[model samples]
Target: MEDRNMKNPLYLQTKMENIRRYSHDALFQFPKKERYLLCRQIEDCIERIIREVIRFQKRYYKKNTLQEIDIELEFLRGLIREAREESYISNGRLADWMGHVDEAGKILGGLLKFYQEKEAGRSGK
Candidate 1:
């Protein structure tokens, strides 16, 4: 039998970790005033994304969780944009951050597609 307790070595998790690290490094550049506001939100969103990736692997019904992750990713992207607009992060940082987010988003899109196809197959049966 397959090992249910085994960790999924997906690149999505790595991407999320990278985002967390990068965001932390970037957040330090933010002024003290924004630290507890926009910075906190971005940090929380990154943490949630990491958590949901693990939950998606463990749960039997994952569509909802995936959708949540998708929303969070979008929110994170928006937060990153806000940072850039406020000049908290530079264009280069924004590019790098967006690259990681885009990669993770693509991995998420694939999982969402797979689960959707699975549901369709079940319904068709």
Candidate 2:
């Protein structure tokens, strides 16, 4: 049986698209008073992380790509917590943002594990 739902570079693209959609909608509803500060920070953090992911992929830095994703995942997790603390986002929104983090982490973890196994197999030869 063929696994048609294979994960490739497009998976990362799809994930980034989701982030962009979420942040764009958030910024739209976010008050103008906090526009430049909170709203922009959220967008910037996500966008920069996405950029790093794309760069790593294009350069084929396999292990480094996973590491970058791990780092950015941590960053996003923290941002969610901080936003919650600052009361910029409601509990529902926090949960929603966390959902994305969880999904991304799972995908990144799978990628990292695959590479780690590959490395182990290579070294055992």
Query: Which model scores highest in lDDT?
Result: 1
lDDT of 1 by residue, 64-91 (tens): 9989999999999999999999999999
Output the worst ten-in-a-row residue range by lDDT, candidate 2.
1-10
Q: What is the TM-score of each candidate against the true structure?
A: 0.88, 0.83
- After superposing candidate 1 on the true structure, give the runs of residues whose Cα lies further than 4 Å from its correct spot: 1-9
Query: What residue pairs are clashing in model 1?
Result: none
Can you list the residue pairs that collide in candidate 2?
none
TM-score of 1: 0.88
lDDT of 2 by residue, 34-79 (tens): 7887777778878877887787677754788768768877877887
User: Candidate 2: deviation at residue 46, Å?
Assistant: 1.1
